[model samples]
Target: MTSAAAVPTSLLRPAVNTAHAARVSVLAPTNKAHLGNLEHLFRNRGAVESTATAAAAPVQPVRRRRQAPLLRLPSFLKRARGDVAAIATQEEQVYLSPRLFQPVPPDGPSPRGDIAAAWQRLHGADGWRGLLDPLHPDLRREIVRYGEFVDAAYGAFLARPDAAPGDADAVRVPLHDPAYRVTAPLFATSSVGLPSLLALAAPCAAQRTSLVGYVAVCENQDEVRRMGRRDIVIALRGTCTVLEWAENVRAGLVPATEAADAAPSTGDASAPKVECGFWNLYKTAGDGSPSLSEMVVSEVRMLLKKYEGEEVSITVTGHSLGAALAVLIADELAGDGGAPTPVAVFSFGGPRVGNRAFAERVEARGARVLRVVNAHDVVPHLPPRPGGRWYADVGRELRLDSRASPYLRPDADAGCCHDLEAYIHLVDGFLSSHCPFRANAKRSILRLLKNQGANVKQLYISKAVDMRVRLDAVDMPGSPLGRLGTPPSTVLECVH
Candidate 1:
C-alpha cells in the first residue's frame, strides 16, 4: 500500500550490484525446486559441502491422497468441454514454468524475415492493425530498443554532477545499437517557479534548465538498409526532478496555439488545447537558451534536410512526462509541413496530455502514435478527466497486464508497475491477451530483478546459483559429481 512518492529515488534509478554479474552468469538450469538451496550456496560458499551431503541424504517418501471418482458426463457435455481442459493445462504449464531463470541466447528471437519489407506495418502505418494482438516479434524488439533509448536519456541526466547544460558530448548517451549516432543533446528550461531535487545544491538559474534528452540518426548504411529507411530518433526521459513532478499534476488545459509558432487555432470553444504544465515545459526558455520545442524542431529540420532524397522516418519515444512531450513534438513536426517523412511516437506509461481537439489535430497532422500501457499502472490514467476539465489520451493503445509475468509479484508497488524496465519486460514476454507470458521470451530477467528490488522474489537469483553449481560439478573434467545436464522441461517450475 506504499505510495510511489514514498519510494526512495534510488529505486527509481538503476542499481549497480557487483554480485549481479556473477549471479546471472550461471543461470542456465531448468529446475525450480533447488532454487532456495542455490541461493544459500552463493550467499554461504562454505555450506556447499554440507548442502551436497544433505542432498545425498534425502530419501523420504510421502503417502498419496485418495482421488475422487470421475463423473459420468453425457456426450453433449463432453463435446461442450472441447479445448477447455487443453487450454487450462497449457495455462498451468506456462504459469508454473516461466523463463525467468533461463539465460538469454546470444542471438535473440530470429529476425522477422526482412524488417525493411515490413517496416511500415511495424511503424504503425495502418494503426498497427494486427501487429499488437499477438505482438509481432519485430515490433517487440523495436519497442525494447526504443525503451532502452529512454533509459539512456535517464542515465545521461543522472550522470551529470551539476545541473548546468553542457556540450553535446557531455550529455550524449551510449546506445546498445551502435548503428545510430547521437547528433545533438537537447535541453529544456521552465519559467515556472518550482523547486527541483536535482539542483538543490546549485543556483536557482542553473536549476531552471537541464539536459532532457538527445537526437540520434542512423548513420550505418547496413542498418539503414535493414530497417528500410534512415531513422531519426528523439528519445526523452520521464519526470525525475521535483519540479517536473509538480508540473505533471498541473492538469489545467490551455490553448495550444498560445505560442507564436504553434498551429493557428480556429478561435472557438473546440480549439485544440493541451495541458498547461506540458505546454510550459515545452515552450518555456531560460535567459539565453532556446526552449525545448525550438531545440527539437531545429534539430529535426536539420536532420530531415541532411537526409533528403533518402527513405527516412522520424521516431519519437519517451516514458511518463516524456511521453507527453513526445506527443507534442510529433504534433509540431508533422503539422509544420517542413518534414516530408512519416512521424511516429512510441509512448510508454504516458498520461493524458490534451483534450479531444488536440488529439484530432495530432491525427490530422499524420503522426502515428502507439501507447504501450500496463493495465495495472496508474500513470496512464493520471491527469484524470474530471467532469468539467477535459483531458483525452491520443494514441492507439497496446495494453499489458503485470500479473501475466510470473517473475513479477502480483502485489507489486506503483513504482514497480510504472518502471520502464517492467514495461519492456512485459512487451518482451507478451504473446496475446488470452495467453500467458511467453516461456521463450528473450529479454533478460536481470534488469527486472534489479528494478523490482524487494518486489520480486529470490527465485531468479536462486535459479542462477543452482545452475552454476550444477554446471561446475558436471563440466569439470575430474569432478566427483557425475554429469547432470539441464533438467527436462517437465521439471521446469517457478517458485512464486
Candidate 2:
C-alpha cells in the first residue's frame, strides 16, 4: 500500500473553477454578406429594414446627406474571425505517452516510484489540464472510443437474456445492421464451479441481466481486415451484478497452483501465475452463472474452425472486476496455444489481477495491454496486501487525471471514481485538446507567408494586465542652469 505521504494534499483539494470573461466584440462585418450589411448601414443611415425582401430590392433614394466614411474592420480582425472559426471546427485531442514518465535518475532500484513521482508532478502541478497532449492523435482517439464501447457493453449485458444484438440497447454500439445482428450470446459463472450456488433475484424484472461474457463476430471488420486478420470483440461487463461484487469481497489470495490446474490445457514449461479467486471465477459458473472459461474457449475454437485458414485476433476488454477476468481470459487464451491469439486487452479501472509472474508472462506474450486507471479510484487498490501477498497489476497503466470531488472521494465506501461514467469522462477529456489550434495554425501560416510586420498580430496580450499605470511629464532642470529650455521628461511606470 502506498503511504499517505505519497499522495499530495493539493491533489486532494477540490479543483479551482477559473471563470474567464469572454470579450464579445461585435465589430463591422468582415465577410461579403456582412459587408453588404455594412454598406446598407452607411447607405440607409443605420436604419436598414429588417425584411429580407426590403433589403434585396433597391433602397428608396434617401436624402443625400454628408455621410461619414464607412467604417471597415481592419484586415487583422477578419483574419482573427476566420482563424477562430476554423479552430472551433477542427478536431483536437490530447495523447499521453507512457514513455514520457521515464525513470528519474535514469538507473535506479526504485524506477517505478520515480516514474510515479514524475507523473504526479506533471499531473498535479502542470498548468495544463491533467493529461499531456496526445503523442499519437489517431491511436488515442481509437482507444478512447473503444473504451466507451466497452463501457456500453454493460448496457448490452443488462438487456433481456434473449435480447438479440440489434435489440434495444442489446449491444451498446452495433456490430452490424439489424439484419446481421449478433445472435450468439456469451455467459459466465458467479463462482468458479462452486457447488450450491445462490440464485439471487434480478434487479429490475423476471429476466436475469447479469450474464458475464459477450462475444460477437466482427460485423465491422474494416479495422481488423486492414491489419490482415479477422476479429471478434469480447467484452466483459464490470461488477454491477450482485454475485460479482460478492466474489470480489471474498478476497482470498491463493497460489497460482489452483489456477494453473484449471487451465483448459497447459502451456509449455514456462506458464504464468494468476490470482486464484479470479481463476476460479472463470472456472466455476455455479447454478446462476455459466462457466466463462469453457464458454469463451469454446467460442474461440468454433470461430477459428469456422474461419479456418483465416487469421483471427481476439480483443478482450472490461472494467473493475470484469477487468480482472479479462486479464485471466487473455492469459488463458495465450497459454492454451490456440490458433487465434488474444491480440489486445483493454482493462479500465481494473484491479491488480495476478502476481509478478503472471504480469511478466503476459507481457512476454506480445499482447497489447492498455490498463486505464482513473485518478485515485479506490477499487484498483483493493483486496488488500495482507501478509505480504504478491498481487500486481498487469500491462502499462494509463492514468486519467480526474478531479477529486465528494462523489470521487477516495475514502468513500462506494467509490465515485470507480464508476464507469467518471472513467469515461476522464478518458474523453484526455483524448480531447481544447488548445487554440486554429489560432496557432493561422499564426504559423502568417509567419511563413508574410514579413515581420504581419507577425505582430500573433502576439498574445495578457488579459490580466493592470492598465492603470502612472504617466507623468516633468520639466528637467538643466544641470548647473546651463540649458534654459529642455524637453519635459515623460515618466512611464508599468505595474507588475
Best by TM-score: 1
lDDT of 2 by residue, 162-189 (tens): 4432343444432211111343455555
lDDT of each: 0.66, 0.44
In candidate 1 the C-alpha lDDT for residue 133 amounts to 75
**Candidate of highest lDDT:** 1
TM values, all candidates? 0.71, 0.51
TM-score of 1: 0.71
lDDT of 1 by residue, 1-496 (tens): 1122343333233222335323323342233423422333233221211112212322121222344212221121112211111111332233323223332221233233447766776777778776787676677888888998898788778777244555555564746555689988888666555456535565543366777888999998877877778999999999876567666777777799647234423245497888877888898876677889999999988988888888889999999989999999999999888546788999999999888889999998899999999999999998787773577889799999998776777887798899998998898878667555665464545446444645554465445444443321123222212243333211111111
**Candidate 2 CA-lDDT value:** 0.44
Q: Which segments of model 1 are wrong by more than 4 Å?
A: 1-113, 161-163, 194-206, 258-269, 387-389, 461-496
Provide the lowest-lDDT 10-residue window in model 2.
438-447
Clashes of each: 0, 10
